[model samples]
Every structure is written in structure tokens, then in C-alpha cells.
Target: MALAQFAREYRTVRRAEGWGSLDGAYYRHLPFQDLTGRFTDIWRIRARSYHTFLHRVLAPLESLTGRPLNVVDLGAGSGWLGYRLARRGHWVAAVDLLDDVLDGLGAVRHYATPVRPLLAEFDHLPMPTGHLDLAVFNASFHYSTDYAKTLCETLRVLRKQGTLVILDSPMYRGPTSGMRMVQERQARFLAKYGFASDALPSEHFLTPARLDVLSTELGIAWRLHRPGLDWRSSLIRAIGGIRARREPAQFPVIVGTCPS
Candidate 1:
């Protein structure tokens, strides 16, 4: 029953956002998305973030461990990131609540390499203890109803020395700015779709203090790695902040590892 409601809300937002044109090929070339398509420019910025994950986190882990890491991509919409990871020879579990062929677990079939698809929630992953070397919340952690549980659950499946990553989630310096961004987003959604799209409980955006708290509570150390921002991105952010009357959010790849 809950899954049905969640699917309905997910479909409503996807249709309202006009993502019908995003097919398998579109997901295939993510980060390097279509130049003329909607949200291409946003994905342009996200490419830097993804590269940061590659250079700063994944590369180092690979060099240190000297083997293909077992990875789980949480909230793997369309399984693009997982497909990419699997193509790199790492085993990947593409997990999401949505099973829609184009934007969900079912989309894993589009890729040539093998990727395990699982329909599961963040708070209760279907993986065995100490089974994975890395767990990544691919633009998905902020949507967690309870981040503490979600993080703990993810860590549960991972070996004690395993790493966890939060990729491409809008993060702010403080709660106030994050809340303001949420208000503006909700207003836009209400105006456009006659709904706030907050039907489900979610943390929405993250803050450093929040991560610090999570770190202390969960016995993990987290580092915020900011992807390089170009001049145009800074200028746009400045203008957008003035127009929105609140500070703009930044997407940083937050990486963490627990002690053995």
C-alpha cells in the first residue's frame, strides 16, 4: 500500500517535470547529457561533482584496495551511475523504490554490463552484513525520511572499513538557508502542479552541522569535497541568490568511512 502511494507521487512529479523524453540513451550518457535537452546545464555542473567522486574517492579506494570494489548505488534512478560503475568492472547493486522501465530499477537492463537491480527502501536495504565495500547515495540521501536510520542501515551492509558517499545533493551552510530553498521550491511546485510534493517525509537538504552530528553519533568521519566551480557558476549563483532572497545551495560529494 505504501509502495503504491510512493509510486503515484513519483510518477506525478516525473510527468509534471516533463521527463517523458528521457529514454534509455539519455540515461546512458548522463553527466555528459544532451546539450539541448532540459536540465543539461545542471548536469554539466554535476559532472564536476561526479569527477570529484572518481578522483578523490573511488580512485583512491581502488589504488588502496587494489581490487574491484563491491558497490551499492542507493536511489539509483534509471541505473545510469550503476551502469557506469559496472562497466568499470565493479560489481554494482542498483536499488530504488521506483521500478518504472525508463527511470527506475528496470532501466538497468539497458546497459551491456551486468548490474543487480533491487526495489528497496533506504532504511532497510536488502543486502547482507559486511557484503559491500562501498555504498553511495546517488543524489538520494536528502529524500530519506530518517537519515540516521538510512545511514546506519547502509553501513550495516558494508564492511567496517567500507566507505559511504553522498553525491549531488543540495547542501547549505545552515538550516535557515536550506529551509528557504525548500519553501521556494514548494511554492514553485504548488503553483505548477497544485501540490507541494512533500507528501512523504524527507530531510530535503543537508548541512555540515547535520553531517557533523551524524558523524559523532554514527562513529564515522566525513569530509566535504567541493567540486571546482567555474566563473559562470559563481555569477549565476550570486544572481540567483539575489532573486530568491536566500543563499543558493551547493552540491558537494560528501564521503565518509567507518573504523574497523
Candidate 2:
């Protein structure tokens, strides 16, 4: 079945079986690191540094939409991306499964208006049609139980020519026993619930091939950047430089727009 159709079907079935409740509890119950704020700080620092070296690669989008951008950050834990986009005068909304993450980001101040957080499932976005200029998935796509469905809904709600930027770690197989065990565990959960398609860690991470599939399905053009070692080191060196770009970066950001 097509991804959108499958997602609608799965969501219906899951909702009927009370499976949606499990995701809410699972994300909410995770043991956050003691230095919770630090993680967000690190993410911001790295992201800014990457922009320094690769801004050339990413800057075109800014010009494409000359006016203030309306952005939505999905899985916006701590609102790092939302805060940054808002700082650049973008009207931003930060969405997440857990309310605590939204509460914690309340302290974040940006140039644009303070963000509004919406609590909703990935498969079921809480927005109207043609509402957003951009939607971002930052390092959290893999955690999505129904990524295909989520992707379709994201496209449905986006305005014609609106962009969807997914930043995620690529999927990989592991050699270590512990890693294999984790993979097995992930597989079991997915099979039991029909929640995911692949067992690789980055199953939700769109590879070039997968990107092609999504592009065709959603009718969006896609571009990818794989950061290099020097780019990665430079980003780490400067933390949050005013303007920078890097290769060999921590994660890849997939940027594409819906067809007009």
C-alpha cells in the first residue's frame, strides 16, 4: 500500500487497539540526562558551527523565501531549532510528544514571537492545511513509530512549495554484540506493532534512495549533505560562531519543498 494509505490505516487500527497511548508514555517516561539543558546547548553550538562552513549550501533557502518564514519544529525537545529559526524572524511553532520539553524551552528568548508548543502524535499532526513555510525533524525521526504516515501528514499540512527539513542520523548495522541486541529489541517492538519497516538504527533517516521514494511520493525535490571531518572539527571548535558551515557534521538535514 502507499505510505499515506498505510499510515491512515495503521493509525486507525492502532487507535482502535489503544496503541497510541503507549508512545505517549514511552517518551514521557524516558530518564532525561542530569545535564538536560546541556544537551540542547550542545545541539545549538554544533548547528551554528555547521552553518558556518555550509551556509553556502543552505543559504539559498533564506533568499527563496525573502520574507519572514513560518516554521514548525517537530520533536522539538528543548526548542533548539525553533529558537534559532525564531531568532531569524521566523514565525515558529515547536511540537513534541512530551509537555516537559515544551515547558523547559519556555525560558528560550528569540527575536520572533515566543513559540507555541502543540502536543500531538507524529502520525497525526495538529495543524490546518497550507499552514507552514517549513517543518523540521531534528535528530528525532527514527523515534517515529509511523514515519511514513508522519511524512505524508507533514506534506498534507504544508503549503504548496513549503519545505520539510529532516535532520537525522543515518541507519547502520552494528558489529558489537550490545548493538546487535539493541537492534533485535527494536525489531521485535516494530514487528509486534507494525510500527517501523527496517531494523537499522536510522530506519527513519532518509537515504538517497529513500529520499527518492519520498520525493516521488510527496512530490518534493530533495537535497542531502554529508559533512566531512574538517567541517565537523571546525563546528566543534567554534561551538556557536555567528556564521559558519561544516562538513562531516553530526547529522544530515533534508530540505525540500512541496509542489506548488
Candidate 3:
């Protein structure tokens, strides 16, 4: 059943290029437009669930790390999470590939905390080494074409004992399922954009075994957390039982810590 749904989603993505091009050509021209609206509408339920989960994750971490910690929100879309962290008294650097998207966040006017917006890619962050206390990839890490290199780059920017948190992305129980997602994503990108199958951005999902290997190779301590849904998610899960049951391991928050 999970495989069937996966196949169906692959076909759906193959059939249409729903948003602007990957390079932000379409959105860059429309400075005043709310480009994130369509994306938020599509992933409305998941987004809400992630938002709740983030708050849950942050509460404890905030207490552990103390206030005014330096944070980097990698792949920050509209800078929502960054803004939230900043508002909680943390200094946040919101980084994304699309400058227009960052500009659209209106962080200066909307957020009370200092939110520094940066236009950069995952593998090539323009940040000083060992400076950040936390680096968050909220539903954004899989966009990297080279996950290993990206992780290494993340390590370079994080201070000793800093945390890397990955949330809201599909995580597989094993390699086979993870590779299946990667193949389907590649096929969809190839069909939709006429690009090489390997060229797709933000399509890879992680498996626990693979993550273990990464943690070992990078010398970082890691742990995985299964996020419990709030009432809203519980109700949605009840109505979408079959869909929810299809992949129990799909969404989880994986944390990696830089060893002191």
C-alpha cells in the first residue's frame, strides 16, 4: 500500500511543474507577491504538525542551552521558523537559495528579534566556522543533491556541542525504502523538467542506517525522535487512517550533536 501511494505521488509530480522554476526566476520578478501561499496551502496539514513539533522540540532545547544562542535556519523558506526562534530570544540567521523568498519574509517589519537573512546554498554557507549553536533544517535538508558534503559543511559552521536538527522530512526504516523515494523523485524531476534525473533538488529521504553511518563518519552523536502529534494531527490521522498507516516511519525529527 505504501509503495502504491509512493508511485502515485511520483506520477503526480512528473505530470506537472506546479510552481516556479527551481532558480526562482518566476518568483524573483514578483517581489510583492506572496509566493509561499501556494506551497503552504499544499502542505497545510503537514506544516501545522511540524510547527507544533518544533515548539515542542524548542522548549526543552531552549532550557538546556540558555537564551541568546546563535542559530542558523538552513533552507529557511519564508523565515517563519527563524522568526519564531528569534522571537524566543535567540539570534537567527535565515539562509535560503532564493533571495526573493527571503525578502518576502519581511522579517524586519514582522519580527522583534534580530533575524539576519542570507542568500546561500546548503553546501556553500557563508558562515564562520564553529560559530553557530544550532543549525536547523526544518523539512529542508533533503534538497541537497549531495547530503554527505552538506552535512560536512554543516559541521564546519557548528560550534562544539552545537545541535543539528532535521524535522518534517520523510525518514525511512531502511535503505531500500529510502532509495525507492530517491528514485521516484529523480524520475519525477526528469519527466517534469527535462533535466537529468540526478539534478532534482530536495528529493532525498534518509534511512536510520544511513544516518548512523553519517554520524559515525562525521564523529557526531545522533538520536532520532518520533514526534507525537497534537489533537489536530490526531484527528487528521483518524480520518486518514490508511494513509497514516502506510508509512509509520515517514516523519521524524533526527538530531545530531557536535561533540565537545
How many angstroms is residue 100 displaced in model 2 relative to the true structure, after the best TM-score fit? Answer: 1.6
* Stretches > 4 Å off in candidate 3: 1-56, 102-113, 189-197, 200-203, 229-249
TM-score of every model?
0.94, 0.60, 0.70
Q: Candidate 2: worst 10 consecutive residues by lDDT?
A: 26-35
True-structure RMSD, every candidate? 1.7, 10.7, 7.9
Can you write out model 3's per-residue Cα lDDT over 2-111, one digit (the tens) per residue?
A: 32343344334533535433434333322223354554332544455455546656677788876677889887765666776776788899887554322333333344
Ranking by TM-score: 1, 3, 2
Candidate with the larger TM-score of 1 and 3: 1
Residue 164 in candidate 3, Cα distance off native in Å: 1.0
Q: Which stretches of candidate 1 lie over 4 Å from their true place?
A: 1-4, 20-23
Worst 10 residues of 3 by lDDT: 25-34
Regions more than 4 Å wrong, model 2: 1-58, 101-113, 172-204, 231-250
Ranking by lDDT: 1, 3, 2
Q: What is the C-alpha local distance difference test score of each model?
A: 0.84, 0.55, 0.65
lDDT digits (tens) for residues 189-216 of candidate 1: 7888777777777889999899989988
lDDT of candidate 2 vs native? 0.55
How many angstroms is residue 90 displaced in model 3 relative to the true structure, after the best TM-score fit? 1.2
Q: Give me the overall lDDT of model 1.
A: 0.84
